[model samples]
Target: MPKGGKHVGKIASKGTSSLSIPGPPSSKPPDVTPSVASVLDELKSVIKQTQEEKEVGEQTLTGINKTHEKVKNEPRVSLYFKQKLQNQYVNALQAAKRELVLLEQCLKKVDEVKVEIGEVQARAAPPSTRNIDDYRSKMHSGLGTMRRGMLMTVLQQYAVEQQVWKGKPGESPPPLCGCVPADEKYRCKPADQVAARVRTEDGEEQWILAEVFSYNSHNHRYCVDDIDEEGHNEQRRYHVSKRRIVPLPRFKADPLTNPEALFRHRQLVLALYPQTTCFYRAIIDSPPKEVAGEYSVLFEDTSYPEGYSPALDVPQRYVLPMRETKKK
Candidate 1:
């Protein structure tokens, strides 16, 4: 009986030895490394410092200018003192100019850094998240809301001017070449992907994916090739008005930094029709809070008596700003 009890005890000891309680996972914080958030914080600090320096430099320049003016206009000032003050003024002016140049360069560097960060974020994002609308939002994210709105208004005005000029006889169309300074802000360049408004055989105008083949400088129009003509023996092409083309955005907008990128409720926009590659005029019923979120829109449809389709949820990539046109 004692031998049996010893065998049982040996089995119990073996079972106890086999049991284990894992020690709590290592509580050490992750190794410190440069991250996107850290870089953004550093950039913000740099911008703030540079802006402050710029204000100070401007103030100093203003003071110097005031003194220089006073010295030049004063008749009582002796020649010796005038000459000395003039030399000092010239030196100070040059120094101030140099400082301003440096500050401008610093601000440009900050912009470059922001662009790099955006590219990194875009590359890290999932493939499904990449799209033209997101790119457009990102490109304009730096602009203030009021500025963006004004830009849109200007574009709409240009569109109107083009339309009016096209109907005139023997008159030169306004230059849509966008060759001047800040040209890109006004016109789409060749080889750029654009959403071009096309009139179908049914006379319905729909926006479709097209590429700018070439610009007709004489007519102020673009020769665009339809992107959906892949299976056709001959490629479909159109000579589209500059006013009818909307360039696709080329970068992803950071939602946190650019809330203005989101469409406003009730704003007119172009949205891809479900189960179709064609884009159509739509009204924003509600905008998504995040860049990745979907937009609720009511697309224009002839079949509906109300002339608008039922509210549909469209992905951010499929929604874009409507081609602006002047109302008659």
Candidate 2:
């Protein structure tokens, strides 16, 4: 069975309940607060120990099966000896299976712990100063509301196509520009829409909308331009590793024809912030109930004391399924 498979539903339900609106901020500091790095170190240790135990258990089961097979095939072996060996194999195999089961549970717990850690970290970290300034500027200039309204209309019209872009459960979403051709020599081409991981001034990486500008074959990196820039002169560019780039989906999935394309309430996602092309981590407060309805999402924003942005309505084109965590 897949890791955490048994706990998937339970976890989702718990997440929904726990993510309530943020309460008023308290003046007192949290007592005995633990550093994120320290906590991560402990989780790392637990994961390592559990992985080792699981491997050993699997090897033991394999060895027992092989030994039993050999004993059964050996005609020269006496019946009494064969029976004794079979009894031992049965006991050993059962014990190994039990151990493997326990290890799987341990892994599931680890994943849950990781999610908790992420929540805490996101809440504690402050929003980017530059982004805040830009947002304030737009609002002051009376451009933010107008831009958001126009964007929402466009997104609503493309809702069906947006749904199809997301990946199925336990899978990575398709690239924004669609999958690269199997025979293609390069993963991306100039002007292709994609998401690139860009590091902010505070040393945190965020996935943002970008367009491929050029490829550096020597270093296997793509030079991409930020798509959110209002003017060509103000646009920023970065040379990112091929692995850090995800192509946008070129096709759409119609929820009318594909029920699976509809997102579930409380599902985690990457949503485009209002009046911006940047995507941020968010949770689906509610999925659209009608074809023309919008998704209600709560974005992770440290600007709020509760570490989450106020619930906002987003069009399907602005929301994508959360990316899968990469294995080490």
Candidate 3:
């Protein structure tokens, strides 16, 4: 299942009206005196531990408390699993989610063209026969096409997101709230639907899922990364468990699986999850040559303009800008 699959930070629960068996209370005077400094020190440590254990669930928090039991004498501060750097992280998560699916499909499935090489022989041939030109030609063949789809998908997805965020044509965010049923939503994907993985001849890359999160000005960005503000601590432990109803990519059985399902699943999860939304920047590159090795998408941020659908042919009478400038 997607790591950190549970909502990181959710609304705190109100107490249930359950009887405590009406046990007799102790007559001893309550020792109200507490070591504020010591408790505060321990609280810091607990917070530190809490921050380290994100993208995790209640069980992990339980274990963390156990490890820090030595310092329990100190006053305890509640730990919550709140979202952090929400806008950038959530957008990054979605972008990562989309490209991940595309990359998996490109790596696992073969192109319909169906060309094969038992092993490429490093054969020396005449320059005219095979050289840089031939190498470029091979890129257009069978497997190349499959890889190209994924690369293009990543690039296009990035372009669309960039445009939306950068105020370019396609850079629009998904709807603000649940205006429509998640299943019926046009661009918004449901959470259980988003899961993606990439596999090469050797093995698969780590499985990942993306969900939305929100941010407020009160939280510290650096500290948020170290904590889940919804409080995954002993005092506020969440009992959320993994549900198998919707199979994420990691949990899927082999054989029936395909690249399409993973992509579809991951996309749905991101859209459906009701988390806060924010914005961030990212860079995406065209996919690498599959023949070289099944490298995953290489994304990084840059100031360059988002890509355009390259014109297939040069426009007639198009002149160089440099030439035009010089003539002027």
Best by TM-score: 1
Ranking by TM-score: 1, 2, 3
Q: Which stretches of candidate 3 lie over 4 Å from their true place?
A: 1-190, 193-280, 288-328
lDDT score, residue 147, model 2?
41
What is the per-residue lDDT of model 2 for residues 236-316, given as tens digits with 9 covering 90 to 100?
Answer: 788888777766545433333233555677777777666566777888897764344567999877768877878998766
Q: List the residue pairs that clash in candidate 2.
A: 161-252, 164-253, 175-247, 175-248, 175-249, 176-247, 176-248, 176-249, 177-247, 177-248
Local distance difference test, candidate 1? 0.53
Query: In model 2, which runs have C-alpha deviations exceeding 4 angstroms?
Result: 1-186, 200-204, 216-220, 231-234, 303-306, 324-328
Clashes of each: 3, 10, 34
RMSD of 3: 29.6
Comparing 1 and 2 on lDDT, the stronger one: 2
Instruction: Score residue 315 of candidate 3 by CA lDDT.
Output: 9
Estimate TM-scores for all models.
Answer: 0.43, 0.41, 0.14
